[model samples]
Target: MLSDLQRETRDEEIWKIKILSEMQRLKISFYFWREKTNNNLSYTSLMGPDKLKILKEFDLSAVFQSKTRAEQIRALWNQFYKLYLLMQNKTTTKKIFCHESQAWLDAFLAPSTGHPNKNNFVRGMYRTQDVTPYIHVLVNHVGEFLEIHQEFGLAAFSCSAVEKKNHMQVCLYFQNTLKDGGHENSQKSAILEMLEHENQQLYFALNETPNFFEAPKKFRLE
Candidate 1:
């Protein structure tokens, strides 16, 4: 078993994972990695399978493409950001995406509807690229936030509103202006628990190479 400090560290990583998962659930476009037992490295998507299930459940055929999903998510997160601002009693024209972290931000805002207990199925590849995707764990929400924006093109993110419920303060970035992702969830508590406890210690450190996407030669948005 791990010691107190070790357990604490591990727990932190768990919370980070939860947060990453949340980003994925939010439909944030990002990828991640982990230091397995030395040789068992792996990477995965964040778009959440439930999204597909949701599409099937509601007969949503338009969300099958990757880019479409990305756009939808960007919009929802904007709304969440606005609400977060109201709770914080802060006023700013800047948006949240510009300041969000690399994979973390992508994953945090990945979910289209913030639905907890759902798989976001985040698209994108994974690799080792320093300064590409940021890194972090739990107990350092602010640091984590900073780390994300430190990456390539996210330095313009602006923390807007604060989420207040039951007297609890949750600094948020609910982007609602744009309509991109297909459809997702909105479980605030679940997302909170994941970011603060479950997915902590999960670092989104730098990689040698950044995940890239390929453009389709033909148009088929029917």
Candidate 2:
């Protein structure tokens, strides 16, 4: 069972996924509300005025802007990535996406999709030479897509330690990226014409890729 705060976080992630799934008929507006904590560095992304309000209570300003529904889709994907990272912790420098790493995540992920694989109706898992310390980025949900939802992806990296010790340094891996809300390549006009900061989905990518570091989550970042 999730704690009260964890439950709230789950709600926040779910709402982001839902509201961003633009409906041709229902137009939804999202805003940053506030949070009870005052830790500014604890969060990666979030959507909804209520969640923003919760974040703001802790001095974290969360906001998103989009002119078209496509942008809104991107925004939703962005928030989930940020929120998940804010909640997870980094502890080891083992190969990310390796059998061991996947084991830990599978416990949490399997309930949803019967565990990821490298095929359709399933996602394949693997690592790439993205960095040193044996760092590997785990990618899942690379191809699955629904009509109105974003496909998700995950990655992990090892934190550079002080000694550069031949010994292993702990790693913080990012899990979960929402991309289905992405607009088609042909929608180039709208994407190019959209507001630069608001238009670029880079933040979407940033928030999706979880950053692991030593932090306290006692009261949701106060």
Candidate 3:
């Protein structure tokens, strides 16, 4: 059912083209706008739904409060990445919070050892500014990840990571429009051209061997 271009390309390659590329562009632009304006702009802000049901396998209703399910997942991954970076930092002098944060990180790292999924029931923790209650958020995130892997393929995680990145781009493009004296229509076309050009340049820079995450071999695609 795949076209020649689609068939020849690996799943991750196809994912890059169809998802990551666009998401990265948009997310970058969005972050630029936020930096320039110092305002928090998000997909939920522009669009009413904080999350969207891109795929309809699991019930995300429990995790989401203000954001939609998809948005919640994006927030979770954002937190996960931030936590991951924090954990990876090998600085000499550690903060007090770092000690507590490690325990949280361990919980995320070891989701199988405890009954995190059944005990907690919060999915939309990303909507808050506080990081103290991250355990609940982490539990929801891991639960969602496992559920998604069980029902869909590992490609779904790839898809999600790409989308999370994509959220930044369109906002950045808006900032470009502001910089160009609010020529919305003309600036949009110009930005699109510029994005395509840069994308091509970056593609060659990657040396044509796109790095991809390993697929979870044990999970069956539902």
- Looking at candidate 2, what is the lDDT of residue 194? 38
- Could you tell me how far off, in angstroms, the CA of residue 154 lies in candidate 2 after the best superposition? 15
Q: Could you give the C-alpha RMSD of every candidate to the true structure, in order shown?
A: 25.0, 23.2, 24.6
Better of 1 and 3 by lDDT: 3
Best by TM-score: 3
- State the weakest 10-residue window (summed lDDT) of model 2: 168-177
Relative to the true structure, candidate 3 reaches a TM of 0.20
User: lDDT, candidate 2, residue 110?
Assistant: 32
- In model 1, the runs with Cα more than 4 Å from the true position are 1-32, 38-65, 90-222
lDDT order of candidates, top first: 3, 1, 2
Clashes of 1: 78
Whole-model Cα lDDT of every candidate shown, in order? 0.37, 0.33, 0.41
Q: Write the per-residue lDDT of candidate 3 for residues 112-195, one digit (tens) a residue.
A: 233457744433222223334556544335434434444453333445566665665665555533433436575546466547
Error of 2 at 52 (Å): 20
**lDDT tens string, model 1, 96-173?**
333432333444434334344566544332223411222332112433343444443223543333323322322222
Candidate 2 ranges beyond 4 A from true positions: 1-97, 112-188, 194-222
